[model samples]
Target: GAGVSQTPSNKVTEKGKYVELRCDPISGHTALYWYRQSLGQGPEFLIYFQGTGAADDSGLPNDRFFAVRPEGSVSTLKIQRTERGDSAVYLCASSKDPSGANVLTFGAGSRLTVL
Candidate 1:
């Protein structure tokens, strides 16, 4: 796809379960990002990967949340010990340029519901 793509548009899990969300970015994009949005809040940045390396991960809430982009194109976000509060829409975005306000193309997002 020319834009970012996220799998499992909806997910339902019980508390304490583990889950994984996937994202595939546009071809040739060097910068990728993950964000999470709760019901009433705006998306909050979770991580940013440049190529296959995570350039920024300060936004991750805890060690239980992790993301990886081993090939620079496909990324996987892993969450352990899910909680009801973790329910949200996980958004993925990509940009060709990593600097200077370059526009990012965002995926429709994967909705997670923890019960």
Candidate 2:
């Protein structure tokens, strides 16, 4: 079975731009989550999707951040009006379900560097 995976691993973007980060979750997993980790800080939950619906998105900072899991598997995180404060490692994780203790298997993450 494949584990969660993310693209770019590193991204350099300027302020006020838009970017899309991709995530590929493990097969057969129905729960996906997105988190952002700043330097020396714990990962902050962004959004979580169960099946095709976003079960939790309150963690999203603002309208500038959005995510979707249209097919109930792969997910993508979109950021708009990027700012230097937004620089962080955006991580994606997947699990069997909440019943599975919500244990998340994480991706290496897409590191965003806003300049």
Candidate 3:
């Protein structure tokens, strides 16, 4: 992909169902991030992965939310026990370096609707 790419541009699920969102970053980006954005609000950081290891995951709301980047180029965000409160757009971003957070290339995001 030329830039960050996210799958399932839109997703609708029952309140208790699970969902997975995938992100394929630029070919050589080393820093990947997962974020959740509510309507009218800025994206909230969920996790940050530097290479194949998670460098910061403190922003994850609970155990139900998890993200991984096994090979450092692609990532997936998994959510279990979905709730209405979890309905939001999941944004993926990638940067060449952790210090380059200010210049991340973000994907269009996957919109999750929990009903």
Once fitted onto the true fold, the runs of candidate 2 whose alpha carbons sit more than 4 angstroms away are: 98-100
As a whole number from 0 to 100, the lDDT of residue 21 in candidate 2 is 96
Report clash pairs, candidate 1.
none
lDDT (tens digit, per residue) of candidate 3 on 1-98 = 79899999999999989899999998889999999999999999999999999999999999999998999889999999999999999999999976
State every prediction's TM-score relative to the real structure: 0.96, 0.96, 0.96
- Cα RMSDs of all predictions? 1.0, 1.1, 1.0
Model 2 TM: 0.96
Clashing pairs in 2: none
Task: Give the local distance difference test score of model 1.
Answer: 0.94
Off by more than 4 A, model 3: none
Q: Against the unseen true structure, what C-alpha lDDT does each candidate score?
A: 0.94, 0.93, 0.94
